[model samples]
Every structure is written in structure tokens, then in C-alpha cells.
Target: MFDPFKDFDQAGYLRNLYGEKDPQIVRGLEHTLFRTGLDEALAHVAKRRTLGYSDFLAVHRILFSAFYPSAGQDRAATVPNIAVSKGNTVFAHPLDARRAVEEGLRIGQDKAALRQHPGEVMGWFAYGHPFLDGNGRTMLIIHSELCHRAGFCIEWQRTRKTEYLAALNAEIASPGQGLLDGYLLSFVGAACERQLWGGAIDGIRGLDGRSIEDAVDGEYTDVRVMQKYQAFEMSRAMSKADRR
Candidate 1:
């Protein structure tokens, strides 16, 4: 049971408004609640002319505040002393999570850059792993919007989960590399209208793909944890330097 917050009141799941304690049941309720909230979330994103870190937070808040009380709060502010990881991949430190996400936003805001380097922009967001929950869905919405603004969108429906995940994981592990970029380029197509995006988002297989459940938490002060994060920072720095 993954409990990154260490506040799971029941069955490794965070406390929810429905008062569900069973992980299985919570999963069902979560899916329903999130779907119920998608229209609002998408509408909110559609109205936004510009995307930023705060807008990213707002997406999570819209989709999850009805369920998780900590909906919009990010790791950097809410869990600053914890380090989060999935399998062998350690994300940015809690304190650095916001900055990492901001880096992605800065790059994505450039329409030209976003069109050319969507994977690198998304890699920073994934590595940042900002929110305790709903990071995947929130980022997807933000990413789709950015792509639309850039005059193209990924044909996510045609992409295989396993392959896409592998590429995404690689991108996060080594930013500035074209691993994900190459994988995603083939799927790029003319942008769909905003009104039709709801169907596209709904067609997505897992709303919270690879949900936070797979994330393991550790003390930020742990020697091994600190070492892992340091390595990631060093690699990120090198990637940036190379780009410059």
C-alpha cells in the first residue's frame, strides 16, 4: 500500500469525502468523482488563454477537491520533508517540486518550443511530480491545452500504454534527450477543437495513469534518498548546460 503522505486513514488510500476506507471501493469512487468533475475541469482549462503552474494546481483542485481535501496543494508546500519516487525513478525533492514544474511551464508556454519539444516540457513536469494525487490527469490536461495552442495535438488514442510509458520514463530519467520526443512525434496531428477535447480526454484509458499509488515515499534526509535526488539534480543541471 503506497501512502506517500503517511496519512492514509484506511487501506493505503487517502481520506476521501465519501468516507471510503477500502482501497478497491475508493478506486471506484475516485473514478466516478473524477469523471463527474471532468467537464468543469476541462471547461476551466478551455477558458484559460495561458497556462501556468497555478493553472496546473487549479486543474487538480477542480477535478479532486470534491474528493481529496488536499487537492490543489503540491508536495513542495505540503510534504516538503518527503521524497517521492516510482520504482527506480526518484522525483524532484519536495522543496524543489514547484521550481521543477515551473521549468516545464516556462518551456511549454513558448508555443514554438512546445510544438518542437513537448516531451522535454512534459518530462520536467513528470519529474517534478508536483501534486500528491492527480498529477497525471492534471498534467495531461495542461499538456493537451499547450499542444492545442501550438496548433497540434498528440494522437494519444493510437499510442500504446506500455511504449508511451517507457518513453515517458526515459524522458524523465534523462531530459534534453529525444526519447519521448521521437516516440510522440509520429502521433502529432492537427489540433482538435476545444469542445471535442472532452471526448478525447474521456477516451484516455487510465484517468490517473500510473496513479500515485505506485509512488514510494522516503524521508528527504535519508542518506540514500538524498544521494538519489542529488544525482537527479546533477543530471538535470548537465542537461540544461548542454542546451545552453
Candidate 2:
């Protein structure tokens, strides 16, 4: 079992409402509910005049409230003492998760910046790694909305999962390098109507975000974990300087 939260006994497998232990079974149900939740979330966001950090959490709530008791709660609030990572990427410390997400939104909301630095914005969101689950789907919906407002959209249909994931991972490891932006630029196209986006998103593969199963967990206070996060910060700082 990939227990990223390290509270499988208490949280019941990422705090799922059903208390499901089987990954495969949980995923099956996730897909079904995610579809329904996506529609609701899209509607909720559509009504917003401007997206903000709170909207991000609201999206998570709308997407998984039925399935997860901690749906809208950020890692800072729910798992502040636990460190989480996926593969080689260490996410922002729980205390900094909110800042990471806010940074992404700050850039993504600017149409010009988003067009030129979509990857940077995406990297921040991925780095934020807010909720224990549903981070992927929540961000995608918000991203699509940002794209729509900006007059362009990523043709996710053409982007392969492996290639996209590689770019995402690369962006996380080396922020502001344009690795993801360059890859995503090729797939950029005219934005579709918002009403049509629901179906388009639903058709895309790997919407689950995969952080739930692939994440490696450690206590935030662990020396190794602290080092990994500190290293991530140092690397990010160097990358920021390089961009300047």
C-alpha cells in the first residue's frame, strides 16, 4: 500500500470516505466520482469572476468531498508534520504549500505570463502539492480555466502521459528552466468554449494526478527529509538566479 499520509489506519487510505484498502478498487471508484465531480467543479469555477488560492481549495472540495473527508484541506493543514515526495521530486514543505500554490496562481492569472511561462506556473502548482489526493485533476481544471481566459489551451489529447509526466518532473526538479513550457508550447492551440471543456478534460488520460500511489513519505523532522527539502529550495534558488 502506498500510504503517503502515513495514517492509513486513521485516515483510512488517504482518508477516503469508503475506507477502501485496495488501490485498484479505490482508483476504480475515483474515476467514476471524478467525472461527476469535474462537472460540478467546472460549474463552480465558471461562476467565479477571478480565481484565487481559495478557489483552488474549493476546486478540490468540489472534486472529492464525497470521497474524501479532507477534500479541500491543504497539506499544511492536514499533514503539516509529514513530508511528501514523488519519485525524485520533493514537494514544498507543508508550511510553504500555500505559498507555492499562490505563486502559481499569481503567474497563471496573468494572460501574458501564462502564455510565456505556463510551465513555470505549472511547476509551482506541482511543487505546492497541496492536498494528499486530487491535486492533478484540481490543477488541470483550474489550468484549463486560466487558459480559456488567456485565449489558448493545451491540447491535452495529443500529449502523451509519459512525455507530459517527464516534462512535469523535469520542471519540478529545475524550476523556471522552461522545460515544461517549451514542451507544452508545441501543443498550444485556440481555446475551446468553456461549456465544451468538461468533456474534453474527461477524455484525457491520467487525470488522477498519481501522487497518491507514487508518493514517498517521511516525517518532516527526519534529517533525510529535511535535507531533501532544503536541497530542493537551494536548487530552486539557483534556477531562479539563472533565469535572471
lDDT of 1 by residue, 43-142 (tens): 8877887777888889899888877887888887777888878777778877778888898889988989988888888888998898876777788888
Which residue pairs in model 1 clash with each other? Answer: none
Clashes of each: 0, 0
Q: Name the candidate that leads on TM-score.
A: 2
Model 1 scores a TM of 0.91
Candidate 1 Cα lDDT to native? 0.80
Q: After superposition, how far is residue 138 of candidate 2 from its true place, in Å?
A: 0.4
In candidate 2, what are the lDDT values of residues 50-84, reduced to their tens digit?
88889989999887888888888998888788888
TM-score of each: 0.91, 0.95
Each prediction's Cα RMSD? 2.1, 1.6
